[model samples]
Target chain A: MGGFLAGVVGACAEAWQEVRIHKGRVLLSLIGVAVAVCALSGAVAMSAIAQQATIEQADSAGGRAATLTMSMQPSDSTATGRQQATQAWFDVLDRYEISYASRVFWGSSRVQFPDSVQEAGMTVVDQPYGEMHRTRMVEGSWFQPGDSARLAPVVVINTPFWESLGSPDLATHPTVTIDGLGGAKAVIIGVYGTSSWDTWPSMFMLTGHFESLLDPVQAAGSMPQYEMWVPPDLARELQTRIQAELSGAVGAQGFVSVDRSDWGAQMDDPTTILRVITMVIGGIILLLGALSLVNIALVTVRQRIREIGIRRSFGATSGRVFFAVMMESVVATVVAGIVGVILAVLLVQSPMVSELVSFGGISDVPPFPASAAVFGLVVATVVGALAGLIPAIIAVRVKVIDAIRY
Target chain B: MSLIELTAVTRTVLIPDADPLTILDGVSLRVEPGERVSIVGRSGSGKSTLLNLLGMLDLPTTGELSFEGESVPAMKPGRRDRVRGSNVGFIFQQFNLLDGRTALENVTMPLLYARGPRFWGRERIAADILDRVGLGHRLSALPGSLSGGEQQRVAIARALVRQPKLILADEPTGALDVETGQSVMTLLDEIVREENAALVTITHDPAIAARSDRHFRLDRGVLTVAEGAARNAGRADEPVTDGPVADDAVAVL
Candidate 1:
């Protein structure tokens, strides 16, 4: 056992010596490998960041994963029946102790801007809506708990709407008058950020405040979009239960519709498809690198035929020769892998690249993915082994007399 | 026990679409411990084929061959290789020192396979042997920088570093000038005597073979005892055996 271990150590030392002696030749062989590893690791790292961005984009538009949304129409054909079904859902929320749930209602506010009265798009939601939808405030806070009782309705306006209001300071309690709020001035408490495509002004206000001041005619046209977040494993069961409960309670028999409305509900997720594409491309690059490595290793073994013959004459067995030759490739590639990963980390972790790949803003820029580093190293080692096999076998088959005579 | 023995070894090489080429035909010889033997032949006279068989580098096509009284032909290839590594060393006409390696590294090469004490103490042993060869100060010198004679001396140190029982010298001085060749041969002869090891010299120069206890000439694939050279020294008490001898195989040393 000791001798076997020594043989391994000896082969490694011998391989290293050969590498050092022929450093220029080895360097020529490893350029492709370094580039390949860099591309692979860098792609994976970027893919991780991009995947998070995609999920956040989806979450911001719909809710987080496993969100169940429901809607209902009554056999009586009145809005009151649907409202009652929504109330039943709220009751279910309280009964089940589901922490993250939101009622989404879309309406318009008649804002009395200094220039003119502009009708701005507004989403009326409960306090938990900000957390569920990954909402970010640009200027001030989201609707805090107890914000619904401020007497003066609080609203979070987007940049366009905030600019329309002359960008008022919230510390001074700037107010905006609305046409249908029964003459009560609405407090502009926060500014909700919008994406580049959001050319029109938009706002978010507490559901309680919106309902208290809402005109009956405007409320008749809007319906509450009820959504609840549950653990993914329980989503299917809960979806069925909510559908049956709402369908039975509304007396619509089967008129109620309860299903997952968030981007997570989509069967064909774009992020997953993108990830597969990235891995395929990474694998191809790695294979090309292996080809170059195999070519160089073959040439190296051929060049060292005489040296190998000399080693055999001195007592090195066939196993020793094979191990040594193969180890040269493994060591070279491992070093190259390390260098490539470091380069990728340096490039990817830079703030510029991170923000750029995330489309300028992501809720959470994930840390450099550990899987990318591991993948790079593991792939490099595998490639080295594959590349070394052909050369090692060729080297082992060399006849001692022919090689010495060579 | 004899250090090595060969009985009627025939080595034939098959060629594509042609008659078989016989490299060595019915060759038989023996070398006892601490004895010196030599064989001389012209070019293409199968001197190297005999050396290859004796050094355990190649298996005979058909023969009964033994080393240190064990049947060598029947040993597993790996076992044969190990036995050769531990018990036999070779010096070549071209020195065959690894290029780009220092004199010390070249000498330490064999000890890498020595495993225990030798492997662990390789550098020191290599340095000591190089010193013994009077090239200790040049241990760090690469072959390209060393004179031809210094390189051959390094080769000698490498062969003797493992202290193998059988030393196979295949035209060890063929590439050297007369004086350098004579000096290298003297150094080799003295080292073998000091170590009490057997030496086998195969050469094309008869003068080089004249110093052996037993001398054989290989011509047209046949080996013959050169006149006035056989049984001249060492192992005189034992008659040249004609057939197989019992072996108390010790596995491997």
Candidate 2:
């Protein structure tokens, strides 16, 4: 047992010395492995951060707004039925103590700016409440209550509308004409910003402003669209109450279609898809890195054939040679793994990397998990052992007599 | 009792796509404890082959060989290796001292292979052996850094370090100059005498053969006693001349 231990120590010392003497080669090999590990870990970290950011953004946007769409017959021209439906919804919401903003629905109409005319789906709201239906203004300002009753109608336009209109300074522009609806001239009161309405061109106006453009009879016949915001936890109860009251007052056909913002649900969320792709890519890179380590260990063993023979000649048994070579490979791979983990941590912490992640909409850097490091080390060691097996066998099987002759 | 015994020992070399070649042909020899013997032959005369067979590095094709009266031809490989490690020491023609190791480490190698744990006391044993071989000052120097004569002395130190019962040297001084070779031979003789170990040195150098207690000539797969004038003739062929009477009276066995 003592002799075996001594042999192992001697072999380890020799292996270390050889590595030291060929420092350049060892460093090169280590760099190969380190780069592979860094790429893998960096990719996983970046993808995870990006996915988390996207989910957070989606939740923030979707959680705040509650919408309900109702389908009515196109020819249902009775004001009594629309009024009853509106009253029923209002009473249900009031019963639940849920504060909501309502928008009267109108069909699609085109709005004309000086340089560009865009078709914007129109909706009329009485007032903004609970920060839920309020659009943030990028330039100019939101419509004031005083502007609601002005002779010329005041309208709020989204950013895309302003940009499409050649970015004109429409802040002081008193009035603009709408080709459809009533063809009345409307005043541009404010410009708001949002990525929420990216799908189509859209703008907002007060119910009075919209009513001013339409004839009294036409306005009376038009169905009003309503959008409401309620706390997410109270949503189910609120929805149930609205449905019950609307069905009772407006007949069995009267029903509310509650729409919860499902930004992530659409297209399965690109960020999550990207995260899964990045993870697969990272896993492949790690596997290649492990293979490279094995190749290096095998080559080292082949190169040390004569040395192994000499050790055997000195009375090292086959088992001893096998263990010594395997130990050397494992030690080398573990060292590389540690260095790789350090480099990965440093890369993730770098200012440039963090900035890039933030630019991709991720604000927080994920902490380097201890589990990842442990897993990497264990994998590297196993790769080392696998790589060492064949070579170790060859080393042990060397004939003492043939080795001395050489 | 003979320290080494060989009965009808034969070693053959088998090569693919070639006929089998016999290197040692049913030759037999023996040496008692404390006896210094030399086997002299030309190149390829089976001298080294016989040495290898005796050293347990090669197995005989059809013969029973013994070391210290124990049958070695039939021993297991592990047992053979153990016996070779503990009971037999070898000096090679090229001075096969591990080039990377210091002189002391080279000498201490056999002891390091002992079944027991190595202790600090192994260093003392190595030091003593190095001192005996007149290389006390060069103990820390690697074999490659040593001169040819110094390296040969280190090899001799290594061979004797285990205190083996038998020493097998194959042309131990074959690569050295006349002066260095003489010093090396003198050192080998002195160590073998002091340790009471049987020494069997195989060389083509007749002068070295004459210096031993008994000299045997190997030629054409046969061993023969070279005595009287023929033994002196072998001595006269020495690269360095010394002690003409001793050379003339040397007996062959």
Most DockQ-accurate candidate:
1
Score candidate 2 by TM-score against the native.
Answer: 0.64
| Model 2, span A1-406: residue lDDT tens | 6666665666665556556645665676677667766666667666656665565455434433344433332223466666666677677668766565555555668777665676776656665521444345666776665767688777776667666666668756855567776677776667765554374656677876776677767766656655566665665666666655566666665545555553532546658678778768877876787677667666766666655655554455566667777776666666777787778778876777765664443323467656556655666667667766776777777776777666
Please give the distance, in angstroms, between residue A262's alpha carbon in candidate 2 and its true position after superposition: 8.5
Give the per-residue lDDT digits (tens) of candidate 1, residues B1-253. Answer: 7899987788999999999999988877878899898876678979898888898888889877899888887887677777888888899899988988999999999988779888989999999999999998999999999988898999999999999999999998899987898899999999999998899999766557767776676777777766543433333233222222112111111
What are the per-residue Cα lDDT tens digits for candidate 1 across A261-344?
Answer: 778788888698879988899889988889988988888899889988887777788888888888999888888888889988
> Candidate 2: where are CA atoms >4 Å away?
A1-7, A21-25, A38-306, A357-364, B1-4, B30-35, B66-79, B104-112, B119-128, B160-163, B192-197, B224-230, B233-253
- Candidate 2 chain A: worst 10 consecutive residues by lDDT? A68-77
User: How many residue pairs clash (N, CA or C atoms closer than 3 angstroms) in each of the candidate models, in the order given?
Assistant: 0, 4
TM score of chain A per candidate: 0.89, 0.58
Structural similarity to truth (TM-score) of each candidate: 0.89, 0.64
DockQ of each: 0.56, 0.21
Q: Which whole-number lDDT from 0 to 100 does residue B231 have in model 1? A: 35
DockQ of 2: 0.21
Error of 2 at A181 (Å): 24
**Chain B TM-score of all predictions, in order?**
0.89, 0.88
